[model samples]
Target: MLSDTSGGTSGFQWHVSGEGPTDNGVGSPQPEEEESASGVSDRRAKVTVIVLCYINLLNYMDRFTVAGVLPDIEQFFSISDGKSGLLQTVFICSYMFLAPLFGYLGDRCNRKSIMCVGIFFWSLVTLASSFIGKEHFWALLLTRGLVGVGEASYSTIAPTIIADLFVKETRTNMLSIFYFAIPVGSGMGYIVGSKVNDVAGDWHWALRVRLQHQTSHSECFFSELNVSLYFPLHFCCSPSFILSTFGFTTVAFVTGSLALWAPAFLFRAGVFTGEKQPCLKVPCDNSDSVIFGIITVVTGILGVASGVQASKKLRTRTSRADPLVCAAGLLLAAPFLYLSIMFAQASTVATYVFIFLGETFLSMNWAVVADMLLYVVIPTRRSTAEAFQIVLSHLLGDAISPYLIGVVSDSIKKSDSYMWEFRSLQMSLLLCSFVAVVGGAFFLATALFIEQDRHLAENYVPSGE
Candidate 1:
């Protein structure tokens, strides 16, 4: 008789030679044993996903919190626009550079342990940042860059775990839920940063407060998960990295610049009309942040939900569902982005409306694209693929965008006209619409190759098989 312990608490004994009796003198498993084994697997998968989603939520919240307080940081340091934007650029550069190493380790090591390390590292660095005095700006920048290293490990590995836990159709819905955190957390970052800054009277305190909240929450949840601590790490490095790079680069440029500067841009553009106070400690009217937060949270949730539903239905009829939906969303987003910028100076209400529409359309691709990647790549290679995508996307996209926009804005201000300064930012933002159009074209092209790639992935067999 052979003992099967794979079921953990519900282990059974089997007669491998087909001639011996089982543990209970029967040839088959007990009903209780079968139920216990299956139930444990199901429960474990659910718990794992919930924990990952929560972590992802905190991940993005930390990412954009600095952007939420960008104006205050600039003022505190007496930094120009380009310098302020370089903060984000530095973070992305570190993140992209470290992703490949993390990706390789994630594939071979215990991913749960890796995630715990990342969470702790970033949280510690974020807390350390709070102590950096105004004179130690470089120290603060270095901490921000370290936070990116921590984030890269978690972001590249978490989704692959999710992919392993679920099948295709169910995976789409689960991924939507997971990715919904991107916008929701981003919006919350704005609200939390602004509210904390208003109450604390310091940008450093604002960063510290948000980081503490996320860190505490993560610690509690990770403890409950009981991640394994022992594993040997191995390090590998994807073409989707190149193909997806182009589209995501364009998207990232717009999203990154907007996330970093939208509130400041609006404040300068006269949307807030609040009194300017000394020392940049003035609590600028938070209407723009609050409204933008609401737009992002609402539109992002609904867009991902709707996209999952649409993609699911379409997949039954066509192999091109994922990229097709992504292409259409990007195309639709382009016009709305243009209109949003056009109305920024004319009417605040119209601008908000267009932004809401544009965000909704643009968000449709997040879950679908992730799903496509999971299906197109084999399980063992998913981490490498994800890491490569992150490297390329950030390198070509957001890493340069904020600084580039700031550079453009500063150049336009050389004429020394406040109106032109405002116009310059407006024009710089308009570039996103054109980039969105290019991103959409890239997605449309992706539709042509995704079907074949997915088939190959699905049919792939191990060498021994």
Candidate 2:
């Protein structure tokens, strides 16, 4: 493996290069593991990327699938806004809490084995959740939480694997392609979930349908026996990691709230405008959901690609390019979100247009943030760094956003008027735009530390400095 070690780093640079950074500038060079004597390193890396993307796509799809059929679930279970919100809350609670455990295991264990175990349980549990009777909504929530255990196992580890495979601009391109799945999967969650539920005349089938995708996501083929034997380190305290994760937290909050409630909000807006009627029965109109899904998919592709390209171009001139792009994305997303919220009652078309713009810009943060984390943290601590980032982001971000938004909306709805539902949700959603500005500020602050942090990670020594 060839490396530029002007820093005289101790540990091999795993994320930036080979298994780790060159040791004391005297590490023996090898032919990049010679494909592990199976002709599988580079080809395998590409395959792994494709498989990981597939897994990510369906994972998000399964997540938002519940949101796609949310109204049906509400009517069938006779639940309140609080309970509906709890669906997301419990899942994120489990996911956020369990991430560190997986991060620990991922750094030490065979990555493929961990994901296989997770997918096994995730599949069985999801299949069973789909059959719960209406009176057993708690069982459904329990199952959703269980599902998180499996997702956490994979989500926390996959990116580090990618970081292990590629470096520099190639890693950015791969990440853009990788993160592209998020919106596409989220949109499919809504589209496939709604259409399936409508066709099956039952929301339960959406869960079952997601299983079809899940059964095929177990193609991992990576190991880390020689990667690191040192005990996993705690989260890096670098300002870049902190600020970027905080910035990403806001993105999570906004996206989480929207994923769980946007369709319902749009439906209520139509009822308030008298363009649509209140749900008189099961399987409510899902036109709003389909439209929103299409918008999400389109914006995700555009945002990730554009953000990556913009950062790549700017990086030639400034080392702070990544954080600046992230800052610009969140800052630009705020005003359009505000407009979307304000226009929902007056004109659906206008609201959709604004949402299109806001979400497109918002989408820019995904790939860029992930790429930033890989570069700004050393390879050995990458998994642990990823763990804490997930914890912090979810702890402050999506974990509570959905439930909090629901509670606020419920508190404001003192009347039986359906219009109150729309109005309250609208008011609560304004928080997203405000949070967006705060996130942008965090990213801007990150620019001050990004270059310094990248240098430190590049030359980082695990211990015994």
Candidate 3:
């Protein structure tokens, strides 16, 4: 193996290269004690999944903690909802823009180091939330933006590592397991922040506030430079898929971002408040929570079962890659997403049902994209590709959609009625839907154009140039 350390940093070079042993797309080469490699495969997958899940969980927690405490923040800082929403916008804006830079770096650097440094930085900034004053608004925004840097680093590199480790057949299932971090982490962040505020009666929800107050300025300065490290040994494996999977998956990704913002747009316009509870709503007692739990359980079962089916389905494929099915899933999902956002305010029951349908369809992408990336990029460039994918997805996708929706909402704010403003938001989904439609077509074309190997042809490189 020709390990590429050319992209790594001084004194922190990594020995790992993204390429597998085979020059042809036969299979990942294994060690001599690997006649039966299933045991090692299971171990690698489980460990990688666990660590990636933890990274994702922490990533979402730091990302959405502000959203959870937005009301308290508004009350304490005397900021309006519109302005507070800018916090999210700022975070996402920096996140989207920096993703490419980070991707470029991750491609040429040690990803584990990047991930660790990023986690520490963001976690510290999250802690710094306790120290800053209301007048230092720009400082807070800067912290949020820096947090974006850390997040961009993790989200970009983690999946790439997963893909490098896993084979194509299991990549979707592996990625799905990784993505489970989103709902769990977001839900937990909200739960933690809301409950802590309720119990402590502190308008300031900073975990490090008391410590910050006690620490001297010099001490604080020193603490900020401290770095944390976590590097795991061994690698996981991913199954491969066709190029069509990547194209279709990306299309699904773009539309799904818009679908995610639909409800929030309605909430912002005050068109459908549903019922605003006190900030202290309990996770177990709340009706939404109960329903969410049932949904989670059912979805968990379905996801596992689907993964099982997919793995089985792969065995029967003459071509060994099921990208057609992947394309169909995305095509099916776009319409449901469009309908969900378009009709969310029709009725409470309708809103909830549609939103669930939207999310259910959107969730399928976790599997598809993982499989696509695992198969598409060679092991050495997987992280780079993943980072680029993140940059693309966020730069061209979610990062812009919310801000665009916000812009549309504000543009129509002076209209005679709020309904007109909401209509503008609704219209934006057409743009989202169109992207999905075009992306789907591109994906289908790419799928057809891809060669018969389970792994993408572009990945195979003969040795010893």
Clash count, one per candidate = 0, 5, 16
Total backbone clashes of candidate 1, pairs 3 or more residues apart or in separate chains: 0
Candidate scoring better on lDDT of 1 and 3: 1
What is the Å distance of residue 306 in model 1 from its true position? 2.0
lDDT of 3 by residue, 1-465 (tens): 322233334222235345446747677664533211122344644665676777676666555555555555655565543465467667777876777676666656556666667666666676776667878877777777777876886787677655544555466566777777765655554455545656666635634332232222112111001111221111112223334433544553453343234324434334434343333222212234323333433443353345335635764863433455455545665676577556655655665565455445444445655665555555555554565556555555555554565565556555635465456556655565556566556556655544434343444653452
- In model 1, which runs have C-alpha deviations exceeding 4 angstroms? 1-40, 217-242, 271-283, 415-417
Q: With candidate 2 superimposed using the best TM-score fit, by how many Å does residue 426's alpha carbon deviate from the native?
A: 0.9
What digit string (tens of lDDT, one per residue) describes model 1 on residues 1-465? 233332222112223434434677857654432111112255566667788888788888788888877767876777877787888888989998999898777766656677777888889998998888877789878998999988997898888777766675667777888999988988888878777878887777767876665566554332111112221121111233245556766777778888877777776666323232223444445456666777888888977887788888888899888777877887898899889878777787888899899989888878887887777776667777788778888898888888888887887775645567567778778778888899988887777777667676777664531
lDDT of each: 0.73, 0.85, 0.52
Which parts of model 3 have CA positions greater than 4 angstroms off?
1-45, 68-86, 100-109, 130-132, 168-172, 190-263, 266-315, 318-322, 415-431, 452-459, 462-465
Order of models, best TM-score first: 2, 1, 3
Better candidate number, 2 or 3, judged by TM-score = 2
What clash count does candidate 2 reach?
5
TM-score of each: 0.87, 0.91, 0.69
The alpha-carbon lDDT assigned to residue 142 of candidate 1 equals 93
Error of 3 at 37 (Å): 7.2
Please report the TM-score between candidate 3 and the true structure: 0.69
Model 2: lDDT to the true structure: 0.85
Provide C-alpha RMSD values for all models, in order.
Answer: 5.2, 5.6, 9.3
